[model samples]
Target: MNYPKFRKSAELFGVICGGLLISMPAIPQAVAQESTPKINPCPRIFYEEPHNNQVVVPQGCPPNALTQRLAAQGLLPVPATPSQEQTNLGVGGETPQPSVKLPRPASGDQTQQPSPGAVSSDQPPLLQPRQTPSATIALANGTVNIKLVNDTATNVTFQVIGDTAPRSLAGKSDVTLQGLKAPVTVTFEREDGGQLIVTPQASSEPGNLNVTFNEATNAAQGRSAMRVEPNGSVFLN
Candidate 1:
């Protein structure tokens, strides 16, 4: 070959190699920029305490809705001390909340429970007081004639128990029970809501008794007037 032609071709090859070497660094730099990931900035942040002189930083951010709701409810996390600055803080999912404690009752504030068999003061008594007879007339040993007069508005029932059968005397009527035994037990009950006020008048003729059932009096004066003596004699009113 010719020397001048050889020298010109060699210079052209060097220019091409120099241009390729310069463009090689730019191509790799463009490829590296396209492959690299973009970093997103966190809107919220949380700090982690240092342990063993090492602290870990987290890339994730805390939730906005949960933090705001807790703040409205007065349940936020405590902050660090003002003297110390927090560094390399981490963003965690959970937030530290304050613990709630209820107040305990004092010893004097405790309630006293009533006993099982205790009775209330406002309740009425279970048994009523026994009544006393207005008057009593003792019968003689022989047989007697007795008369019962009902002066009430309703019908009255009188029984000369075991001496004779029971009899029902109408309202404003009279009944005569004759030849009854001396120790007779007589019971009277009204048909409606009224008690019999018996008043007795003993005859001086030896063996006659007049018993009258008047209108209903008060309950304190005794509903009836009769008693049985220990000597087998019956006193009636």
Candidate 2:
């Protein structure tokens, strides 16, 4: 009986070893390696054609062989030529016309004369040159006294009559004849009516500045002289 028990135990141990062997899994196989993606070497090219059979390469095309060939062969469009009728020829071919001027009117050509007793241009009544009167200028202290002989009028303008005198006299309503330093012929003119004026030459001192008055043109209405005292008093002789 004991020998059979020993045989049973050996069978049990063999069954358990078989079960362990079945539970263990087999080793996995190695995965296959992947290759890298390769990039395309050439870029795309686009062409535009506004006219038939005329291709235009836009700016973006690269300077590769294909683009250079297209540009050299003139596959690109060409600008149109202008018609001959639209051209500008200068004015060199035209002729100019002549302009005409009209004649002017004629003026009077005959000479006319005035009758007797009327003023005549030929042999006009010899208007004796106007007779100028005698005038005198007296310089005493700081005052100047102007006197006229046979002067019927009141308003008169007297001026120094020499180039050496100041171009114009100073400090007088009318022109001052006393400022003439050299021997000057002073002239007295009447503004309204005829009057006599006596003008004297330059004097050394104020004692007596005497000037003779005579008709400027006639010289014969006799002569008159005026004496000027140092006290601004004027005496006619």
Q: Report the number of the highest-lDDT candidate.
A: 1
My TM-score estimates for the predictions, one after another, are: 0.38, 0.20
The global Cα lDDT (0 to 1) of model 1 is: 0.61
Name the 10 consecutive residues with the lowest summed lDDT in model 2: 85-94
Look at candidate 2 and give me any clashing residue pairs: 134-197, 134-198, 135-197, 135-198, 135-199, 136-198, 136-199
| Highest-scoring model, TM-score | 1
Q: Residue-wise lDDT of candidate 1 within 1-237, one digit each (tens)?
A: 699999999999999999999999999899999998543332123233232123222223332444444546776553223211112232222233558897877998877766789987778989986545433444556566778888877898777767656668998989887776655567887867577777767666556767788776666543543544434344544
Cα lDDT, all candidates: 0.61, 0.39
- TM for candidate 1 is 0.38
Query: What's model 2's overall lDDT?
Result: 0.39
lDDT of 2 by residue, 8-75 (tens): 99999999999877665322212222233222222222222232124333343223344556657886
Error of 2 at 143 (Å): 16
